[model samples]
Each structure stands twice: as C-alpha cells, then as structure tokens.
Target: MWHSLVRADNLFGPRHALTAVHQQLDVLQGLLEDSRGEYRHEVLRLSAQYAESAAWLHEDSMDMASAETWTSRAMEWAMEAGDEAMLPWTLFRRSQLAAGKRNAGQTIGLAQAVQRHERALTRPMKAAAIQQEAQGLVLDGDESACHRKMDEVHEYAASVDSSGDARSGHGDFCTPSYIEIQRANCWLNLDRPDRAVDTFQTALAELPDVYQRDRGFAQARLAIAYVGIREYEQAAAEAAAVLDMARGSGSGRTLQEAVTAGNALAAESNVPAVRDLLDAVKESAGF
Candidate 1:
C-alpha cells in the first residue's frame, strides 16, 4: 500500500500515502502493545522506520507538534533496537525541522547532541550533524561559524570512502547525494547564492532519479538563489520547474517554500517574471 501510494503520480496519491503510513503505524503500535513474548527485533526496527516516516510527513505538513512526537518515538524505538545509525539520523531530521522553524538555538542544540553521541554515528551521520550545525549557524547569522561547520562537513565527507556500510541509517539517510543537497541548502540560507547554485548543480550531477521530491526541493532552492542574484530569467525557469514538480506531489513544505520565494519576489515590480510568479501564487490557494 505504501509503495502504491508513493508511486502514484498525483497529489491525491501522496495525501493517501501519508494517511496510509499513519494508519499502518497505528496498527504497529497496537501490535507492539499486545505482544506477549519477547519483543521482535524486526518489529522494533519497523517501528523506528515508521516513526521516522511519520516525523517526515508531519514536517512536510508543517505540523511541528506531530513532527516532534514522531521524532521522539523514532528515537525511542531506535534506541530499543540498538540501532545507532537511526538515532543520529532521526535527530538530524529534527534539526532540519527546527531550522525550518527558524529556531536556530534548537537546531544547534540538536546537532551538538548528535555530535556528542558521535561514537555511535557513521561518517554520513557526522556529515549530517555538520550540515545541520552549518544551517543553524547560518540562521543565527554566524557566518564564520557556518563556514567552519561547512569545512567540517567537507573534512568528514573526505574521510569516508564509497565502500562503507550501505545501511548507515534508515531510509535514504546514508546517501552522499542527500548530504550534498543539504549542504546546498545551507549555502542558500547563508545568502551565498553562487555557492548554492554550484553546490546544487554538483548534487544534481550525482543524484539518482528516484527522489523527485528532493530534486524538486533543490530546484526550488535554486530558484531562490537565482532570485538572490537578480537572475530573473533563470529564477523564473526554476520556479516553473518547481511548480511542475509540485503539481501533484502533495508536499506542503515544497509548496510553502515556493510561496515564500514568490512573495519575496513581489517587491520587484519591474521584473515581469517576478510579477508572473506572484500572480500565479495569488491565483492558487491551499498551498
């Protein structure tokens, strides 16, 4: 059911997907409560994965309370499973959510917690921590600290070869391409549009074809970068691509980012592309 919902090429599909995932998780919670014998390790693992999924879905929906609840559950299940990889990765998701909320203090605290628990973390986990720290620093307007964290990310990435354990974390957490995308976003948030554009292009070069949502997000950030640089034409092109990708994705986070970018462009009345994007946004509701 999860596969079918995720594979469906429409907005309703993703909406249904979220609902199905949540329902499945409820069933799993019931089973966990009713279990009589020794707890199954696989069940614990599934619980962790489901919790992580719920947290992600909640974050996408901008439901911070739900997101935090699921993240806490995910961490609990991961610890129960003795799944070190899951712990840091889940924390990383929380940090990202905190960053989205512009809670730089919370973001940095989460990232620091992950780093303090680094003995259990894999190289990719370390990279994620560094990326989150960088983002927090960016939000706090600590340019030097952000750059320092970015450097740490590069150092961590350089230390690991491509032949390490493939399953470092749950889901797509272990992918280098994912790390690159996060790094690109950090650059964007730091107001380094040129660097953001370059990093995003690098991410696209190595990124797989499966994660359309991630790709769409990168495109949206790219649009913002273009806007930052006064490249209205390129920004418009990227925004159009983002709109096309978001048409049926059911990703509230992406839609929100697009709306924010569009609203920012509203100040530039002389730019036709900006006016057009703003008009498009005004015409659309429920984003």
Candidate 2:
C-alpha cells in the first residue's frame, strides 16, 4: 500500500496520496502498540518500511530534515529488529541523503561504515558498498579513489551469478539498473559528461517503461552533465523531457535537480535556451 501510494504520488501530482500514507502510518503505529512480543518484530519491520517510504517522499520534496528524521527512524527500527544486514543498507541510504545535501564528510563516514559492516555481506551487498564508497569519494573530490572504487564495483557486480537468489542486504532492490544509475551518477560527479551521457543512454535502452520516474531521474543527471559541458541546447532538451515526465510525479529530488541545472544555466546569463529552461523550472517548482 505504501509503495502504491508512493508510485501514485510520484506519477501523478496528487498531494492526497501523501496524506493517505500518513494516515496508514498512524494506524500501523496503533496496531504495533497493541501487538504482542513476537509480532512486535514484524511491526517494527513494517514501521521501517513506512519510514523508508516517507524518507523517499520527503527527499523528493527537498525536505531534508523530514527525510533525515524518517530515514533515522527506519534505521532505528531495523536495528531493533536485530537485522545486521539492514543496518548497513539503512546507513547507505543515510549516506546518500547526506551526499544529496553536499555534506561530503557525513557521506564518507556513513559510506565507510557500510564497507566496514560488509564482512558478512553477500556479493550484491559488497557491490552496493563499493558503489556507496565511490559516491562518497566523488563528493569528497577524491578522483582516483572514486574511479578505483567504481572499478571494484563493476568487478564485484560482474562476479555475481544470477542463478540463485542473490543473497544480500537489499534483495531485489539491488537490481542491475540500480548499479547502472549509480555508475552514471559517479561519471557525472567526476565531470565526465560524455561518459555520463553514454551510461544513461545505455541504461535507458534496456529500462522498462514502468520505471518512468527512474528514467526521468537519469535524464536529469544527464542534463546536468550537458550543462556542465556548456551544451545548453542538449541540456534544455533533456531538462524539458524530464519536466514533462515529472509533471504529476511529486518527485522533489528530480525537480530539485532540474531546478539546480536550470539555476546554473541561468547564471551563465548568455544562453537563451537556458533562460527558457529556467522559466520552465520556475513553473514546475511552483515557487
């Protein structure tokens, strides 16, 4: 139900979906209060999921404080459940949240903890840990370390046989597309605009239509790369496409990226396409 609400809110511009989720969370909290000890664990797990969903929503909206609060709550619940694997996964999310805020120190610290806790992790988890480390390194401006970590991520990912259920902290959440997107992000942060564009294009080629929001996100990153390269025409084109897809999707993160890119272009002051794109962003930002 929470997933459905998140999808609906993301795909459609419906504020009511968020309200519904909050109502459901309230009910779940009441139920947890009345549940027994054995059931408490299950309740905690559900609470964690709720918190995670809330964090995603808040992050999309650029509500960093709310996002952090919910993500922290999710981690606390996962720890209470005594799920060692989930602890690292939640820490990874926190690292990502910090990175989004451009807090390099926090991102690096959380990412290192993820790697440290990966001793008992399976192949996929190790790949994810590497990916997080790469992200942190990128934010910290450690170009060599970032590239090396990305290589390790690819190497680890390539070794994972898909014959059995890929044992990891995240299970089905650790999909190939996820890794590809992470790599694309790393390329973008490293100022490899051409590489970032290529990676995103490749991922989009095999990506399903159901994941439109994810695709929009990738395009937003690609647009940023275009902006970095001073390719105003391409940046405007991609930013427009992303805005069209994100119209009703309540994805604050995607919108924020678009806004940031537009702001950058606007600051350039000489690009007409960029000015037009900035106008579009202002409309979408509803500010």
Candidate 3:
C-alpha cells in the first residue's frame, strides 16, 4: 500500500501525494485512538513515512512552513519507530527544501549530516545526498566544490549500477539517470544552459517509466534551457508538452514551470506556436 502511494507520487507529483499522506495520517490517528498493540510499531513507522512524504510534497509546492512542520513530525516518528534508516533521509528532505530556497548553507549542512551517518545509508541514498551537496555548491557559487562533489556522485552512481538490488524502498530517487538530472540542474544554476540541455536530454533518455513527475521536471527544465539559448520554437514546444503533462497529473509545480517558460518565450517571439503556448500556460496557471 505504501509503495503504491510512492508510485503514485512519482507519477503524479505533489498534490496527489499530499492526498495520499492525509489518508495515512487519518488511518494513523484512528489506530492510535484504538490503541492496538499488535500494530503499535507499524503505526509509528507508517507515521514517519507519511510525515516525510508530506514534507516533500509541501516542499515541492513551495510551502516551506508546512514542509518544516511535516519534516519535524517525520523525525519524531522515525525516532519513536526506532527507524534509523529514516534519519538521513529526513535530513535529505530538509536539504531539498533549503535548496529550493537557495539557502546553500542550510542545504550543505543538512547533506553533511547525512554523510556523517554514511555507513547506515544504502548506496542510492548516499548518491542522492552527495548530489544534493553539489546542488548546494552550485547555489553557493562554489564551482570547484560543486565539480568535486559531482565526481564523488559519479562514483556512487557506479556503485548503484553495479549492485543488482532494487532501489531501497526507502524511496530515495537516486537512479544513475537521476544523478545526471541533478548535474543538469547544477549546470542550470551555473548559467550554463547549453550544458544543462545536454545533460537533461541524457537523463530523460533513461529515466524510469514510473518517474513521470521526474520526467516532467526534466522536460520543463529543458524548455528553460532552450529559452536560455534563444531557441524560442523549441522552448515553446517543450513548454507545451509540459502543460499537457501538468494538466494530466494536476501538478502545480509543473504548471508553474511551464507557465514561466511560456511567458518568457511569448515575450521573445511572436510566432503562432509561442502565442498558443502562452495561452495554454495562462489558462493552466490561471494567470
């Protein structure tokens, strides 16, 4: 049931994921009120899972206040459940929020905390955390540090590939392709959209079918990269595709990115494709 919810989140993005979390919280509260001993540990562990999922959903929606609340709740439940696996993951989640806000100090600090427990983490989790440090470095304007960390990330990615085991059901998004996606994001942050475009396209080629939301993110960023390079037609096409995916999945983040890209394209080009894309964006974004 939990894995299915995670699949739904990966496919549909935050709004649906938030819905799933609410349902779990409701179930947890009912179980608590009933005081069922047989399910005691299960409830606590599930609480941590739902709370962490909620934190990520809120963070993706840019609701930092709610994100922080859920992140704290997640940690509390993790401790109560004796779930040490969740420790670094929750910190990783917090780092994501900090990254979104461009708070490089907080992002790097949280990722280092994850590394402190390096032995406990699965390779995929470790790779994801290290890549996040690279993300923070990009935001911190530390190109040298970012490049060094990315090298470490590739080594971790190789380990992930060599291991035949499935990604930890801990739900860390750390596939080898996901690493390249993060690299693309770093390039984007560095104002080198040409490099971002190359990396983003590579990541898109191999991203798992289940990661529909992740694919949308890459596509949206690719659109932004096209605009950065003054390829207005390509940008419009990519943005239009993003809007279609956004509409299908009810993904607010996707809609916003598409709209932002569409607006930029509209400003630069008066072509029919650009105009149509802008109209779609405005309708989707209610702008």
Candidate 4:
C-alpha cells in the first residue's frame, strides 16, 4: 500500500495521490490504536510515515493548512514511537513547509533542528537538512553563506552509499541530480536566471523518469527562468508544456508555477505565444 502511494504520487501527482494517502492514514490510525509493545512501535512508525505522506500531498496540492496539520501529527507519532530517524525527518519536512510559506527564519530554525539530531540522520538526511537551511539563507540574502552550505551539501551527498543505507526509502531523492536542481532553484532565487537556466537544463536531463511530478515542477521553474531573461518564446513553450502536465496530473504546484510564468510575461503580451500561454494559464487558474 505504501509503495502504491509512492507510485501514485510519482505518476498521478498530488491531487490523485492524496486520496490514497488519506485512505492509508485511516488504516494506520486504526492499527495504531490497537497496537502494543514492539508492534505498537512499528505501527507508530508506519503512522508517522503515512501522516508525512499526507502532509506532502497537501503541500503539493497547495493546501498549506492541511499540510501543517498532518506534519504536526507525523511529528507526534514519530516522537511517540521514539523513532530517531523519522523524528528528525519530520523536522526537515516542517522546514520544507516553512520554505513554501517564505518564512526564512522558521525554515532555517527547523532545518537546524533537523541537523542538531546528527546521530539520528542518514547522510542523505543530513544533506537534505543542510541544503534546506542553505535555501533559507538564500531567502535571508546571505549569498556567500548559502554557497558555503551548498558546498557542504554536495560533500555529504557524494558520500551517500547509493546501494546501501542511503537507499532507505526516505530522503533517497537527495542525489547529485536533485542537488543540482535545487541549486538551480537557489540560483533563480538569487536573481541569476542565466545560471539557473543552464543548471536546470543539465539537471533535468539527468533526472530519473520515476520523478515525473518533480520534472513537471522543474520545467515550470525553467519557464520562469526563461521569463526572467526576457526569452518570451522559450518561456511560452516551457509554460505550455507545464500546463499540459498540470492538466493531466492536477498538480497545483506546476499549475501555480505556470501562472507565475504567465504573470511574468505580462510585458510580452503582444507576442502570440505569450498571449496563448496566458490564456491557458488564466483558464487553468479557474479550475
């Protein structure tokens, strides 16, 4: 069931994946209530996993309130189970949600909290938390500090044993390609869209096929990068691709980025491609 939920998120995107997540959460809750001893601990861990999944789905679907609720629940279950790994993971997840809110202080604080659990974190987990903290630093306008932390992120990520403990289901996406993609986003935020365009193109080329939704979001970001450079034709093309993915997958994250791309192209409204893309984005926004 958990594997199915993961596949659903990858293939069908968040809105569709959320239904399965909620169903699994219901089952986990029932099992957790009646569990005892070691079995109870296992159930609590499972509960935390499902709750985290729910939180992620909600976040992807642009429902921040529900995302926050489920993240807190996941944290509660992780702590109750004394799950060393998941406890820090939940804090990292909270940091991600904080990033979505543009709360740099909260994002940095929560990511630091994750790193504080040094003994509990896997290498990938450590890299992820540190990368997240670096992103928060970017938000706080600390460019040099962010780059230094990003260097550390790469160092930790390089040491990850792909075939060993690093392959553990959680935080497995912290690969070199993923790290590069994140760096591209940080570049975009730092107002270096030229570098972002170059980096995003390279990272996207290496991204795994299983991460379809992530690809969609990345492409959407690329569209925004094109807009930043006044490349209206390229932006329109990329936005059009993102709109198709958003329609098929019901991805609010991708759709929202498409909207952002369209808004950024307002000055190029006279261009035929930009006009068409804007129309599609406006129509999609209604849904």
Best by TM-score: 4
Order candidates by TM-score, high to low.
4, 3, 2, 1
lDDT of 4: 0.86
As for candidate 1, its clashing pairs are none
Can you give the TM-score per candidate against the true fold? 0.81, 0.82, 0.90, 0.94
Q: Model 4, range 156-212, lDDT digits (tens) per residue?
A: 673323432223667767777778888899999999999999999999998777678
10 residues in a row with least lDDT, candidate 2:
159-168
Model 3, runs deviating above 4 Å: 33-39, 158-167
What is the per-residue lDDT of model 2 for residues 1-287, given as tens digits with 9 covering 90 to 100?
65566556534533436667677778878988898786888888878777776776777766789888988988998888776766787887898887887888888888788878866566677677777777888888898888787777755563223322222235333346657777788888878888888887787775544455667787888889888777888888788777855666666677777777787677764677777787788787663
Between prediction 3 and prediction 4, the one with superior TM-score is: 4
Whole-model lDDT values for every prediction: 0.71, 0.72, 0.80, 0.86
Q: What would the per-residue lDDT of candidate 1 be over residues 1-287, giving only the tens digit for each residue? A: 44443433123324446787888898888888866434655677778877887777767666779888999999898888777777877888888888888999999999888888767776666877887888898899898888777766755562223322133342323356767777778778777888888888888777655556667777888888878888876776677667745656666667667776776677785788777787777765655
Clash pairs of candidate 3?
none
- Which is the better candidate, 2 or 3, if ranked by TM-score? 3
Comparing 1 with 3 on TM-score, the higher-scoring candidate is 3
Candidate 2 residues lying further than 4 Å off, grouped into runs, are 2-17, 119-123, 155-173, 267-275, 285-287
Model 4 Cα shift for residue 276 (angstroms): 1.5
